[model samples]
Target: MPASIIEVPVVDPPLAAIGTSDGDEAARIQARLIELGFWVSGADGDYGLTTRQAVMAFQKYMGFNDPDGKVDEPTAAALTNMDLRPVSRANSGTLVEIDKGKQLLYFVIDGKTEWVLNASTGNGQSYTEPDQNTPGEIISGVSLTPSGLHNVNRERPEGWWEGDLGEIYRPKYFVGGVAVHGSNSIPNYPASHGCVRVSVPAMDWIWESGIMPMDSPVWVHDGA
Candidate 1:
């Protein structure tokens, strides 16, 4: 070794991205995430993979853009003081309220949020599906989840229920070819063909619990 040569070690920067993953701050954040309905099954103050995923889900539903799952100052503040809520003009009854703007699904029974789940709705894009009006042909329509009052007309307890555009799990059809179902991929934005996409576990719960039964009212709207 040369006496004149000085070897300096490189230092890494702190993980100061967003949403604290560990520490008291992270624990508080996790508690808030659970309160705000972001599903933190393992919220124990330790910022691990589960906490990160829960934070990501919160960011997605809250309409914040932190793809890295770090809660920035603004995001943390917003999480603490979030005011975005699903609004239903309906007087009172058992119904499922879906907010496409916020990508959230609220299982409301008699005017209470029984279960809150991260959801995705229509992406307002172009899509093609088999035409029921014509034989051996397909039809094109805008990929959209219509915002209106509907009834739970049908349901499919089977998994991976096939659709012309894609597949859904344990779908409960509300309108014509549109349902609030389960999907493995529920992003932070609207990405469904024309249905509401919830978590697979959530879908199973909906079915097993029979929350939204047949003929139950379903209200789909957004104030954003």
Candidate 2:
């Protein structure tokens, strides 16, 4: 070893990318997400699908370019600072606002956005599928998420219901056949058959919270 040579210690960057393993770091992240109104099934140490969805929701709400659900140094810092909370577009009353542009859902209460979740809406693409009524014939329609004010006219309280396109869990129909419902796959981008798709756990929480009840106002629009 040279006398003038000096040693430097390398340090690992701050990250909590949880997988199957359970740890306190995962639990802390989950708790913070829940506190910030990102719906996780529980604050357990396991970073499962629910926690991942919640992290994704938080990232999307914060307008991150890459919301990959990975808790990196930037995400950890943002989580520590609690000033960034989502706001509602509406002026008054409680309602559900679906921002198609952002692919997010805002649960507004008293004009304040209390909860934010990642959502997938219509992809604005034409599709052809077998008609349920007549399997031999094909049906065609554009996958469009209707914009404007609507109300919860119908809903399926529990279990999965077979829809024209696919199975929707606990659907809360607002306009025609379109509803904000639980889905198995809620990608960061808009991809749905004319429905608002949130994580299955999120949909369960929404039902339990009663945020959007029967006749509850639902406003769907592109981002500002």
Candidate 3:
């Protein structure tokens, strides 16, 4: 008699991306992200803007290219087995690290990057814009995200603020006239004038959670 052959089963990879509304899949992804300390607002079974932004942040943290917030096979696989997390440059302290080169922000707790976010820093371009502080006065300077050690000096806890350049949401001022604020447009690369821009929801979370309190050390570096 001939030997019997055993059948092997094939498994399919997860498929979810921007605009995908599969509740189960979306919830799974969101839960995984939250478990990894990613800020997804909540796992509400909706792959919406907040979820997409969180996915983008995860991709950037993993050093993936073209982080388009697509949870395809590769992205899902990587997410499933992800072990690497951003390391804090500071030896030991609770601080916020702004990586200019990576355009990523890290919430470091005791030298460990507990959470990460997609951030848009300065674009390094010269510009002249109306200064909100002074009427009919224009300010001229380079749009540069200054790299140095600083601390959170002040913060606007509620509502949008009319900054020198434009409206910033819940800005946490660190350096002189520079802050880590919220914006609707936080591109992959640097785009802000001088402030570090994150999502509005993220800024809200920062304030509501009291993660970055007053005088919290903020280290801005080029990651070089």
For 2-28, candidate 1 gives per-residue lDDT tens digits of 222223322122123345557766777
Position 131, candidate 1: lDDT: 52
Model 2 Cα lDDT, one tens digit per residue, 126-221: 999986655588879999999999999999998787777778999999999999999999988889989999988888888997888999999999
Model 3 C-alpha lDDT per residue in residues 98-153, reported as the tens digit of each score: 98977888898766667778899999999998999789999999998889999999
Error of 1 at 111 (Å): 1.7
lDDT of 3: 0.80
What stretches of model 2 exceed 4 Å from their correct place? 1-21
Q: Per-residue error at 85 for model 1, in Å? A: 8.5
**Ranking of all candidate structures by their TM-score, best first:** 3, 2, 1
Q: Write down the TM-score of every candidate.
A: 0.70, 0.87, 0.87
Clashing pairs in 2: none
What stretches of model 3 exceed 4 Å from their correct place? Answer: 1-19
